[model samples]
Target: MDPHGYEHLTPAEAIAYQNQLRQKINICELTTPIKTIAGADISFDKNSDILYAGIVVFRYPDMQVITTATAISHTSFPYISGLLAFREVPALFNAWNNLYSKPDILVLDGQGIAHERRMGIATHFGLLTGVPTIGSAKSRLYGKYIEPADKLFAESPMYDNNELVGIALRSKPRCKPIYISPGHNINMQQSVDVIKNCIRGYRIPEPTRQAHLLVNKIRIENGDNRTKQMGLFD
Candidate 1:
């Protein structure tokens, strides 16, 4: 099944496709003032083909949740190491189409430009929607870095093949740092700063933390008995 013509491709073809899209990534300073930001995440229904995609939009500095969106779909793509965007992003696009208002930037619970392929879920989603996006993951997908200081707002540059690609951000003191990278139309430093402002005494930031809760809420309401995973990036 072709869910936008690329999902059905063979593994080799998918890698090539990722390499092609990688060229389209634009890493530059954000010119637009960020008033609203949306945190995007996806979860799978236990032992089933159903997947849920969620988006939570909130005021930037105020951090007030304004609206939320969710989409359910049967994903035809399988989970792979480098081709994660293909498995997850179609459902996200379904949710994106239902959003009340487009966010100025999207903070996603997955890799951005910092993937082995350089085209992770965050970057793919940003290109598809033409919005600035950032990827904040609980784990590192690629890039090398030393651990940042165990304090709030500490970060270290993450490099892949000797090229700086992202940041390892310590959002809260004594907590494991979250990996952050630019998805589209934003620089690495800007991505780190945006996530830092969204933290609210948790390892995960508010936008994504709220989004994680909302998606789990939707999954639980749908009769899934799985326990909620506790991480901002999950």
Candidate 2:
């Protein structure tokens, strides 16, 4: 299957494809020591079809910036809530290809198994690239959960029926909780632990928050005049 061939897919076709790939998802604990971690995000203006995808790698445990990659591409897929991977992953794949230093794990700014079909952008990307990924979404895409406590690191289990899907975590005091789920090559508990390590006085974890800022910065700097790709390293 051509991983980038999602552009021409109908909504039904996309759903079918997601169903097909989801069976391959492996949920387990990460066995390797995590020396590096990365975050991925997408940004676009509502009035434009251009998408800015950014990936920021950081030295894990310490959270120092390592390298960043950004890609600008045009997506033809319409905004479908459950099928967002079809619209976003192509550009993110381009950015991933240009990354010089791939991290040990990735924190995607979207859902993982916490989706209706259990095939969110993070899971899709992990299936495509065979990387360990976790979704740290700002909003709950799927699952039912009680509100977490107001203190930092407080969490509540999120469930779809009787199945555990994700967690609603309070990363900062008085802020809304962030949703976390394992994408691939990781488990729910490990996902929460990794996200906890990434938070630093912010509602969103540092990995994904930094990636969001990077993509939006690129979008604002480039404007809507042209589509291009760029990368930065530190």
Indicate the worst ten consecutive residues by lDDT in candidate 1.
Answer: 224-233
Native-to-model Cα distance after best TM-score fit, residue 223 in candidate 2, in Å: 2.0
Per residue, candidate 2 scores C-alpha lDDT tens digits across 1-234 of 565788999999999999999999999989999999999999998678899999999998999999999999998998899998999999999999999878999999889999998998999999999999999898999999999989889999999999999999999998999999999999999999999999998898999999999999998888654433222221
Native-to-model Cα distance after best TM-score fit, residue 63 in candidate 2, in Å: 0.3
What would the per-residue lDDT of candidate 1 be over residues 57-116, giving only the tens digit for each residue? 998888998899999888777888878888888888888889989999999888898888
* Per-prediction TM-score to the true structure, in the order listed: 0.92, 0.94
TM-score of 1: 0.92
The lDDT of each candidate is 0.86, 0.92
As for candidate 2, its clashing pairs are: none
Candidate 2 lDDT (Cα, 0 to 1): 0.92
Error of model 2, residue 55, in angstroms: 0.4
**Minimal lDDT window, size 10, model 2:** 225-234
Give candidate 2 regions above 4 Å deviation.
225-234
